[model samples]
Each structure stands twice: as C-alpha cells, then as structure tokens.
Target: MSDAILTLDNVTKVFGRADKPVYAARAVSFALHPGRTLALVGESGSGKTTAARLIMREYTPDEGQLLFRGVPLGKGDARALRNYRSSVQMVFQDPFASLNPTHTIRYHLERPLKLHQKGLTSAQRQAAIVELLERVKLDPKLIMPKFPHELSGGQRQRISIARALAVNPQVIVADEPTSMLDVSVRQGILNLLNDMKAELKLALLYITHDIATARYVADDIMVMYAGQIVEWGAVNKVLDDPQHPYTRLLLSAVPDPDRRFDDVRFADELGRVEEIRTLSARPQPETAQAGENHFYRPFPAV
Candidate 1:
C-alpha cells in the first residue's frame, strides 16, 4: 500500500439530523495501489456508492482525509484540484443514464480529452478517440458515430470505460460496472477491466455485490456491511476462509450448483440472519488478523 495512488484515511460521511445521524460511511479506510484492483463487495445500501462518491470528490468526507500521492486532496490550489479530478475517474453502474442522450459516442470520449489533454489538435483528438474505442475492443469506425442509445448495455459500459481512460487517470472507480449488462457479456467487460489494469498500470476500485465477479478480477477484496469493512485481504484467502459472519453470509448467498436448495447448512445460517446483521452493524473498533494477508473486525459479543 506504500505505492497507493489514492488513500482514504478513516473517511466518514454522515447524513440526517445531528441528534440522530445516519452514518453513510463511518471511518472507512482503504488504499488503491497501481496495477491492482480492490473489490468492495456488499449488498444494496451498504455504502458502496458513498465510498465511490468520496473518491470521485462528488462528496467530501466530513471526518477524514482523502490523499492522492500522499498529499491531502482539495487542500491545494485550484489547479491542483483540477489535476486531482483528472487523475481519478469513475465508471458508473447505469451505462444508459451515464451518457448524454443527445451526443454521439465520439463527443462523449472527446470532451474529456479536449479538457484534460490540451495540446491535441482536432484531428489528433479524433484519432485519440478511435484508439480508445479500439483499446476497449470496440470497432471505432462502426461505433463512433452512434449515440449511447444505439449501443447495447455492454457496449455502453465499454464506452464508459473508454471515457474514463480518455483522461489517462491513475485510479478508476468502477461502481458495479457489469451489473446492468447481460450475463454472457459480463465476463468480457470484466476481462476488459483486467486488461486495462495490467496494460495501463491503473489502480482500480471495483465496487460490486457480486462476489463471483470480485473473485475473478480483484487482487484484494474488502467486504463491506452497513458502513464498515468487516473483512478484507487477499481475494482467495478472504473468500475461501471468510472470518466475519457478514462475510460468510455473503459467500453463502452465492449460488452453488452442487448444493441442493433445502440444504441444512445455509438454512441454519439463515435462521440467525437478524442476529448476524445486528451484530455486524454495530461499530467494532478492534481488528484481528486471520492470516498474513487476511483480517476482520470482530463483532462485539451479544
């Protein structure tokens, strides 16, 4: 983590009334290193999007610091903020809604390049768009003229990836990048993300609830519940030997072809669902190491 391009140090974001606050994120800390992907896995309303917003600078952390290359973000001059903005890019979940309805795909990719990459001439910018399209495995000639609506879900997601890469960002915050696409196409998109990370040496924060896909793409994984990362570490280590109850619950929920529907093991776990959720939701400051690269925050005793 010493080579982290972006680090969130005990970042907290709160909402609702001062007297009765809702903790969207509470002391969430993680680092995104170059050429590695950190998958943040959780169910809906688990504060995954809140963490993405914090990284994108869409929401400022109320309690902690966001550091880019070891310097606190937003504390520097206007130019520094602009540079930071350019360095961290986001690929939203809803590909259809993320792009402009009125503009062509070329315009979507061109706008960022024209803004962040200034020296390129009109012809050069156009060529750059083609290269980006090609990089994402799309046929530039066939796709550039079409608007976002004209493309399928997978294609639009690729365009989103292309646009993020358009700025040559150091970190890519992909929030459920494949959830909206067809099941068949999900692997392809995931492969593209993996390819981009390896080729560009980009630090990726792939946020998703899909543990299956997280296992496929991530070098490291963090399991988020309520607003805290209850378990985290090497992808295989954590997934294979999940320490936190919430983490185990998530893994159990994943479909197993070999197991029957009425299996007794998962049923037993499901019986204590409420108890597990309640305990996991409580703030636990203590962390215990389960392995050299694996750790979990122990739930307070009931």
Candidate 2:
C-alpha cells in the first residue's frame, strides 16, 4: 500500500492476566491507502474486530505503532491528535445502537462541525449538514429532523456515513456496515461506500466475516485466523485464487443465487472444518507468494 493514509506497524494486542493470556492480535500488520478499501475477513473470535478497535483508538496497541499520515500516533502533539480524531471517524457495526435515540439526525451531524470546525457559524454548519445528507443520497429536508427509530435501516446507515463525513474525514473505518440489513439493501450500502471512496479519495477499512461482501466494496483483502493474517492480496486475486486453507473454507460459505447456504452440499467440508482450523492455527514458517498478487502461509505437515 503505497502512500498509505493509515498504517499499523506490527501491531499487537492482548487480553488477560500477565501469567496467562488471550492474544487478540499477534504482530498484525497492514495499511490503508486513500481512494482504496482493505477488507479484513474472518470467522467469529478471529481478531477481526480487535484490529478495528485498535485503529479506532478504542484500544491502544500493547506492542506496536499506529501511523497516520506518516506520523506515529499516541502521545503525538495536541493538534495532531485532534486531527486524527476528527479525520478518522468510524461507522460501527450496528446503526441502531450507534445513533442517539433522543437526538435528531440534524443534531448528530451539527455537533461534529461545532466541535471540529469552530470557524463555521450556525447557518454554515446547518447548510453543511444538508449537503452531507444530500451527498449520501438522502433528502435532507425530510430526514434531518427524524430520530434513529424513524428511518429505515438503510437510511440510518446513510446517516451514519453522513455523520462520518461531517468532520471531513480522510479515512473511514466501517465495520460490517451492511451485515444486519436485508439482502436487497446490502448492495445499496456497498455501492454508497464505493462511491464515497472514489469521490472523496477516502481510505477505508471495510471489516467483515463475509468475503462475498468484501469483494463488492474492497480493492484488497486480508484473511485473518487466530489473530494472524493467513492470506492477503488484491481482492479478486485472493478470492478467485485463494492460497490458504482457511481462506478457501470461508469462500466455500458464500451463497450463490442458484445455491443457498444449505442445499444438500458442503456436508463433507463442514465435517472437516476442525482439521482445517487445526492446520491453520499452527505457526507458519513464512509467507509464500502463491500467485502474482496472492500470498498465504502453507499448512504445516500433520
């Protein structure tokens, strides 16, 4: 990732006592460049969310550095840290939980401008809120005064994106933005993310367990397992030509229009998942360049 807007340098995070430990992240590393998205995919308890937490500054890395615009974060100058907070906003996993039930959407968007762009007056801030709503394809006049429960799931998500843009962020961390929405609406949310990335030149971290959705929004993909990135590369290259057993296992779960999640198939693969996990959890000797753009760790001999 050349000219990255955000970079995690050998970042590590742990949860538990010093005597015993649950290693949530182990030397995890990656970068997010402007106008591109990096999708982090893995099953439950696979450290996908932990990585997001680290980038969001909800959890500081116990072991490594987080760099924003080539400057190392944590203990930076007051002005620099302020910029980081304002410029790196997150769209959480649940739109319903993230928004304020008591406040109107206009209040949510206006407060950020008040706190971050103090130069803007009340009239200018109000105008900017409407523009943001318009940018996300919402009717500002109709939706601005509505509370969270009043809008549809997709509309709430668009409001979340609009609020994220309120601070004029250069990087967006969207964790499973569409996972909870109806399938019919998922594509619309994905397309909105794609358009935001291209038009605003915003770097994005699109985190999810679903590789199929990852393909729709990201340019690059990283497959995580047991706190390590087992495979990564260009999204299509890695998905179409997966080199890791774990990656293949995940890809196998996607629903095809003709084939549902259960259609009398994958019985054998489902039965052998424990074996795949066993092999995948073993320490890899090194990364192997398995394709022109794909890379993964080979399973150790049984």
The candidate that achieves the highest TM-score relative to the unseen native structure: 1
The C-alpha lDDT values of all candidates are 0.92, 0.88
Best by lDDT: 1
Clashes of each: 0, 0
TM-score list, all predictions:
0.97, 0.94
Residue pairs with backbone atoms closer than 3 Å in model 2 (clashes): none
Q: Write the per-residue lDDT of candidate 1 for residues 1-302, one digit (tens) a residue.
A: 54888999999999999998888898999999999999999999889999999988878889999988898876567777678879999999999999999999999999999889999999999999999999999999999999888999999999999999999998999999999988999999999999999999999999999899999999999999888989999999999999999998888888878888788898878888899999988897898999988999988998
Kindly list the per-residue Cα lDDT of model 2 for residues 147-200, writing each as its tens digit: 999999999999999999999999999998998899898888999999999999
Segments in model 1 whose C-alpha atoms lie over 4 Å from true places: 75-78
Candidate 1 TM-score to native: 0.97
All-Cα superposition RMSD per candidate: 1.1, 2.0
**Where is model 2 more than 4 Å wrong at Cα?**
77-80, 257-268
